[model samples]
Target chain A: MELSLFDVVGPVMIGPSSSHTAGAARLARVARQIAGDFVRVSFGLHGSFAKTGWGHGTDRALVAGALGLTERDERLRDSFEMAKAAGLEYDFYTADLDVPHENAVKMTFFSADGGRLDVVGASLGGGRIVITRIGEYPAEVTADAPTLVIVQKDRKGMVSQVSQILAAHDINIGVMRLSRTARGEVACCVIETDGELPDGVLGEVRSVPGVLSARSVSV
Target chain B: MYSCFADVERLCAERGIEPVQLFVENEMRLTGRTEREVYDRMDARLTIMEDAANRALSGPLGSVGGLIDGLAQAQWRYAQGARTLCGAFLNRVMARALSCSEVNASMGRICAAPTAGSCGILPAVLLTMQEQYALPRRSVLDALLTASGFGAVVMKNATVAGAEGGCQAECGVAGAMAAAAAVQLRGGSLAQMLSAFSLVLVNCMGLVCDPVAGLVQVPCAQRNASQAVGALLAADMALSGQLFPIPADQVVEAMARVGRQLPIELKETAQGGIAATRRGREIAREILHRERA
Candidate 1:
């Protein structure tokens, strides 16, 4: 993905966290893409990022941005102050994940309608970003691209069956990442493929047995 | 159809230009922006980064708790020197690279290519070579053009985003570009430039994008220092006639493969590596707690 100065460079941001402090918040907001309105968010920060997260304003940034704010949004700094005003109910926690990154954040957001999303994000520096998890999928999706994220049941021949279908249409999947959900019954595949998603692929994927829902993201 | 260094060299010789210069000219054509424009954007951004660093460092602190202070202070000093030498009006890329180092910083705001994370590597290597060799500005410009060409090739075939690939994509690619540019500066033919480009990529492929706490401090700052040094080394080797077992194109393809295989946590998610460690986690908590307090 191509990053502009506004994309990688910061200052129109809240303090403390760019990846977790600010980006964690942005990831929550983007999580709304799958979860929809009326959401409950649980934020988990890994060890070091967690310790300094508050001072970095990550909690506020995540909450505020979750309530709907952009990195360039002026209100990002005051997101915490505005959370009460916005009536956002949220919880923050710390965890020791056996991951190598020093600034990782995971947010699991549930919509009122039973729709939910799990987003793992990292701030890669210069305000650059990467979304590493969605639901239970282990893939890297850019919040800056047009992406297709599919959540489905894990079954034999699933990938091949889907790959054959995509290849038939001459669509090249740039980067395909799959992670089994917590339940292990389902798997989420995040595809950062080149070109636009064909209009009806979501419906087609949804029709597949064990396929829960397929969503397309353009940010 | 054309795959080897010889093919690229032959093309460059036929075109009456060095191999690296061909890359630069091609980059200019593809971006649809002039060399001056790219330079200007990079220059401008450097100024902004320097000013921000200064603002961040205004007050004296307790003991240096984390990495931000050291990197920001270094960037501040580097920026001041860059502004003095390159003038405030240089290109953003040039300015940013110079500002990150003392001798070459520019005088203004500019655009940062690939990213602002390792902005200093490219210009620091290229400009220093220019001064050291006493080459004309045009020669240096050709080298930059060549580097841009290689950079665009990577952008097309693989990835440059630290988020997608890793710091390898950022500093690594910068080093590759600089190596090719340096080859041109040394008057190496196109084949030599390609050798340099390939050599750099082979060594840097698969390097991770693990920025600590996502601050652009820790690894990003220190990484820039190493990246600049690496680019110079790669260029020097290429100039001296080192050969790579792998092709440049193949190395780029390997980088893409590595980026794909990279765990999401390693590819800039900050979920893994140093970003997720006990110390990294503590620093994050401390920052958050301080904010809340």
Candidate 2:
């Protein structure tokens, strides 16, 4: 998509650093949307995020976002106390992860029901983020538009079925990517739509044969 | 997209329209939003800038890294007193710039005009102009639109991230944006506005980004204030009939080239310039010690 005038002019964020704080919060919020109601989160920061993240309030920003706070929320400064109150345990580590970007983080979230999700993302300056990996599937999810992240078995006609369901709802696909571990193995389909998916579309997607899980994320 | 100032100038001259109108119409076409929606969104950003510029004037504000605190209030106090040599207008401009930067460092809500590190320059100029000239709200908003157009052109031609292009890309572009807005607010011609924009860039070329301790405090806040003053002076120069030899688009290209040539240590890495000084390293170590404690 082309850059807008507003993108040059404003994001209306809480900040000491836009890439470190606002972008960090946004990345965490996207992670929260993907993995709902996690009980604990561990952040493995790399490069600049590891060296200066604390001074730039990256830790607070990440915790605030994982607690479901927006970037502009004033409570971002008090995120640690709020996380304690919310019973959302979090830990930060300076990991030596090999990432191309200077501002990257690998997050592992644990849910109360023994479910776990791994997400790796980078803050690509100016309050923009890209979720690079979800679990074992390498992905590129910007959350710029309403997106559907579907995890299913790598089988024939899976893409056709999902596209047919979305086409039935009048949702135009802006961009779509499919990734799998191997042939006929677990796979991930990331589809960004031009508009929000109508209610019950996700349910229809989940009910599809061989579809393990389907989640909608909009920012 | 409106990528170059030369094209913008040509289109404006041919159509006999202002930059603000062109930008608003382009926004309407791109976002598929009504004119009212675009203006309302910009107006909301103006409100946030106003809050940040004024929030730190009355009291001291603390930064996240503990490197600097209450400097905005100090500047405000000095401006209010009779001791400043630059008179009330410039003093208040610097104070407002420092105020907004201080608020950003303290994790207060702010509108990042181009980026967070340089958020203070544009708002300081616009708000101070409005207060001093008693300009109408509509005119100030129009000036803001003009600045956004100038910024969009810069973003298309060059970089705005400090890490990519040094402080020149962040603070220098911000000053240029403010200078263009100032010219528009003062009813200058399109040529004059572009001259002011180019002059600001020329004045701030090659300024490095070296925040002490990798926090957006210290030199960054002070640079905002200095660049706010620089923008006003550049606008005044354009209004007074001074001409810059280079065009605005060429200046932006030159800035891009210079930013690429700057060393990595000088580009927001906190490893060179003032950040690498003995005192700078000492301050970084102190902050690290405190964080560990």
Leading candidate by lDDT: 2
In the range A58-78, model 2's lDDT, one tens digit per residue, is 999999999889999989999
Give the per-residue lDDT digits (tens) of candidate 2, residues B1-293. 35699889988999999999999999999899999999999999999999998888887678867555777778888888898999888888998898889899999899998999999999999999999999998999999989998898888879998988999899999999999999999999999999999999999899999999888997999999999999999999999998888988899999999999999999999999999999999999998988889
Off by over 4 Å in 1: A1-219, B1-10, B19-66, B71-110, B130-139
Residue B109 local lDDT, model 1: 21
Error of 1 at A132 (Å): 21
Residues B1-293, model 1: lDDT tens digits: 12334455567667786554454344356456675775564445444434433332233222113454334344434545655553321222333343442211111122343455555666566655554567776565555555655676677678777778887887787778777777777777666666787777777778887756555555665566666666667777877888666778788888788888888888766677777889987876675455457
Off by over 4 Å in 2: none
lDDT of 2 at A117: 97
Best by DockQ, which number? 2
After superposing all C-alphas onto the true structure, candidate 1 shows an RMSD in angstroms of 10.0
lDDT of each: 0.60, 0.91
